[model samples]
Target: MVLIFLFSGIQAYAVDPEVPDSEEAISAGQSIFNANCKTCHRLDQKLIGPALRGVTDRRELAWIKQFITNSQVLVQGGDADAVALFKEFNNTVMPAHDFLSDGDLTNLLSYIEFGDKVDPAAAAAAAGAEGGEAASSGGGIPNEYLTIILVVLVIVLVLVLVVLGLIVSVLTKYMNKNDDLDEDDKAFINQKTDYKGIFKSDGMIIIVTAIVLAFVVKTAINGLYTVGVQQGYAPSQPIAYSHELHAGQYEIPCQYCHTGVEIGKSANIPSANICMNCHMHIQNVEGKDGISPEIAKIYDAVDNNKPIEWVRVHNLPDLAYFNHSQHVVVGGVECQTCHGPVEEMEVVSQYSALTMGWCIDCHRNTEIDTQGNEYYDKLVQLHSESSNDALKVKDIGGLECAKCHY
Candidate 1:
C-alpha cells in the first residue's frame, strides 16, 4: 500500500502539463524576471521582497497565479493569505502583473521551482570550472610582457643599424685610401657625412620649426578638448570603499547602494544606514585584524547620527539636465554603459568624458529598446511606418537641443 501511494505521488508530480520543462520557456522566463522582477526579488536571498525560491511549493498554483496577477485586488478582497503576506512585508505592495499570460506565469513558476531544486554548491563549482576554462582559453600574453619584448626588439634594431653604419664608414675610408675616388669626390663625401653641420643648415632649421609648431598646435587642441572633461578623475573619499570587493567579489547589485537610480535624477550616494545594512554584521575584514578600521568608520557615523561624506566621482555641468530614471528605468541603459567596469575599480572614477559631443554621439548611435515599454509603442510604430530602417534614438527627439539644455 505504501509503494502504491509513492508511485501515485511520483506520477502526479511528473505528469503536470502546466509545469514548464523546456529550455526555451525557462530562458524566456529568466529574461522576463530580469526585466521586471530583479529590482525586488532574488532567488536565494531577500532584497526588497522575500526570497522566491520554493515559492511554488509553499503556495497553491491557483493562489500564486491570482496573487501575481493582482495582489492589490486580493488584499482589498480581504484574502487571508494575501493580507498576511502584505502585512509580513511591512505593507509593501506587490505590483500587479496582469499583463503576463498564463504561459508566462507557468514558466516563471517553473523557473522558481527548478531554482529551489538546484544545489548551490554544485552550481558554484560548475561556474568556477567554466570560468577557469574561459580564463585558460582566452588569456593572452600580458601587456607588460609584450612591452618588454617590443623594447628588446627596438634595442636589437638600434644595434644592427649602428653596426651597419660602422661597416659603411669603414668601407668608405678603405675606398678613399685605395684612391678609388677623386680628391673633390672624397671632400664632397666628407662634407655630406658631417651630420653636425647638416643639422645646423637652413633646411634642417625649417624642418625643426615646422615639427615644433605642429606639436604645439596639437598640444593646444588637446588641451582645449579636455577643458571641461573629467574622464579618469579619481578623487579620494572620506571612507575607504572597494567597489571591486563589494560589487565583484561579493556580487552586490549597483542598485542596492544607488537607490535613486531607478526613480530619481541622481544615483544618490548611499547613506550610512545603507552601509550598516551589511557592515553591521560584517564588521571585520577577512585576512586582516579584528574589526576593519574602514568598516568602523561607518559604525562611528551611524552611532553619532552623522552621514559619511563620500566624494562624488562623476559630475555633469549645471546647463545639462540628465535624468537617471529616464535613462535607467525607461531607456534601460546598463550602469556599465556610463560608469565603465565599476566592479573592477578599487576606487571609482569618472569613466566617460560626459561632454555635450559625447552625449550627442550616444543619442545618434543608440537604438531605442521598445520591447516591454508601452510608452514607446506608438513612437516605434510610427517610426517603422515612416522608415524601413531600424529606429535609433536620433530618429526621435533625442537630438533636440531643448530636450537636454532646456
Candidate 2:
C-alpha cells in the first residue's frame, strides 16, 4: 500500500521542462544546497549573494548552469548580466562548482524554483509562530539596536547614580540639622572613606597580588593543556589541492580516495596515481587552454616519480593510538562526525580537538551498532537484561584503556 501511494505520488508529480519535479530529485538538490550554496545564497531571501528563487526567469537555463559552474568564465567573456552581478556583489569570487554534473544542477534549479513554497497566509502563520525566539536568535540583535540598548542602559545607570547622590545629600543635611544628635552620631555621619589609602594598605595589595598571580597561573596551565591540541591547524600542501571541489561539491565518496579507512588502522594518503586517474585527462578547467598551475604540480610529480610532500594536518600524539577502521567501519561513524565539513573547506583543517576527553565523550554518547555481528549477540542480550537503555560503546569495553592504548 505504501509503495503504491509512493508510485502514484511520483507519477502525479510534474515540474518545468528539464527541471525535476520528483521528491527524490528535490531532496537530493536540498542536500546539495545545504552543502555548498547555503553559505552565500538563499532561495527566497538575499544572503551574501542574491536570492536565487526566480533566477530561471531572469536568465536562460544554460546560462545559469554556466554561471554556477564557473561565474568568472562568463564575467571575463563579457557576458553583460554576469559582469553586472560580479560588480554588484563587489567581485566576490563565488567558488567554482564545476564539480557539479548536469543532473545535479537541474535538480538544484528544481529545488530553487519549486521546493519550500508557502502561500502568504501560511507564511504569516509561520512568522507568528516564530515571533520572539526568532527575533532574538537571528544573529543576536542588530549592531545598531545593540548600540542603542547599551546607550539607554548607560543613561539609566547614570540617572540612578545621580538620584542616589541627591538622596544621600538630602539625608546628610537632615541629619546635620538634628540638634538632638550625639557627638559620635555626627562624627559617624560626617566620616569620609579613604579609598586610595585603603587600596595602598597591605591587605588590598596582597589581594590584588594574589589575583594577578592566580590569573597568570591559570593562563599558564591552560596553555600547557593546549600544547598538543591543534584543533584548527591548516598547513599549506606542496600542491594546492582543494577538498572543497573534490569532496564537497563533486560528492566524491571519501572511501574512493582514502581507500584504507575501512580496511586498515591508518587512512593512508592517496598516491599521485590515484590523482592521475582523473587529472591525466582533466588537465584544464573553466574553458581554459593551458594546464593549470596546481594541476601542473601533480603532473610534474607523476612524471618525475617523486612523491608530493603533502603537509600533515591532524597529528595524534605518539602515545595515543587511533584506528580508522575501528571507528569508521565497525562503529559506522561518518567522516563528518570527526573531520567536519571537508567538502566546504578549500584548505582542509583539523576540525576536531582529537583529545582524550573528546574521544571519551563520543564513546560515552555513541550507541554501539551490534546488528549482524555474531560477537555482539550475547553482549547485547546481557546488556538488555542489565539496563533498558540502548547499548552504548562505553557499556562495552570502549572506555577501557586497553581498547585504544597499545
Candidate 3:
C-alpha cells in the first residue's frame, strides 16, 4: 500500500496538467497556430520565442492566456516571469493574439502538448514515402541500364565486323589455292579493295545520300518536337533568392510564398510585404552582423513602393490554358509532381518540359484520385463497370483538346 501510494504521487508530480487529447480539438488548434503562432514559435524548438510544450505545467492557465493576449501589458505590469522572459529574449515583444478565444487557447495547448508524438509506424511510413518519391522522380531508362545497352550494341557490332573479316580471309585463301581459276579472276578477288573507286561508286554515293537524308529528317522532327520546350531553363532573377535555404532547410510551406497556388489560376508571386513579415524581424541569417544583401533589395522595393521584377522561369504559350486551382486544390496534385524537387533548387527552373505531349503523357498515366469526391463518384462507378483499370485523368476529359485550348 505504501509503495503504490508513493508511485502514484511520483507519477502525478511528473505529468503536466492534461490538455484535451481529442483529434478535433488538436486539429482546430493546428489551424490557429499555423496562421498566427507558427512564424515565431514552435512546440519543441526555440524560434523567435521559447518552446511551448510545457506552458500549461509551468504557469497558471489564466496567466498564460493573459500574456498571449498582450505580453507588453504583463511586462509593463512587472509580472516577474513575463518581464524575465522578455529580457531573456533580448526584449523581443511577442505580438498580441487578442483574437484567439479561451477555447482556442485550450485547443492550441492541446496540440502543442499531445500532437505529433513521434509514432514509430508513422515514421517508417514517412521514410517509405520519401524513398518512393526519389524513385519516381527519375523518368525512362536508368543510367546503368542505358550504359549496359550501349555496351551490348558495341560488342554486337564488333562481333559482326570480326566475322566479316574472317569470311573475306577464308575466301582469299581459297582463291589463291584453286587450280581451275584463271589468274585474272584470282587477281580481282585477291587484290586490295579499291578504296578510291569505292568512295566514288554509285552504290556508295546512294548509301551516303540515304544516311544524310535520314539524319537530316530525324533532326528536323526532333527540333519541331522541342520548338518551345524549355526544360531546365533557369533564369537570373533581380534578387538572389535561395529556394534551397527557405523551402528546403527552413521547411516553409509552398502555399506560404506562392499564395494563390491552391486558390486561383496563378501561383501569385509573393509581394515585398510578405518578405517584410519575416525579414523585419529576421534581418539576416543567423551569425551575420547586418541585413543580407538580397533581403536588402526587398526592403528597398517595399520602401520605394516599386515592385521587384522577378524573372519568370516557366512559360506556357498563349494557346494553352492551365488552372493551378484545378490541379492543386481539386485534383490534389503536389507542386513537385510538375515542378520537380523545387525545395532542393537554389534557383527556380522549368523542370518539366511543359509541352502538349508531356501533358498528354501525364494524363494517360496518372490515375484520378476519386476518393471522397462526389463529382467523381458517378464517373468512377461507370469507369469500373466498363474497365478493370483504375480511372486515369484521360478518362474524364483531361486530354480533351478544349481542356487546354480555346
Clashing pairs in 3: none
Give residue 148's lDDT in candidate 2 (0 to 100): 71
TM-score (all chains, Cα) for each model: 0.45, 0.46, 0.46
Q: Please give the CA lDDT of all the candidate structures.
A: 0.78, 0.82, 0.82
lDDT of 1 by residue, 228-256 (tens): 44778776677789999999999999999
Please give, for residues 1-406, the per-residue lDDT of candidate 2 as tens digits.
9578555644444435788667888888999987878756678776557889878778889999999999999999999999999997768677889999999999898888767654557788666554433333224444456667789999999999999988988999999999999999999988877889998999999999998999899889867755644788776667778889988888888888999999988898899999989986886676965456678677656655789878788888888899999989899999899999888999989999888999999989998989899989999999999899899999998899987788
Quality of model 3 by C-alpha lDDT: 0.82
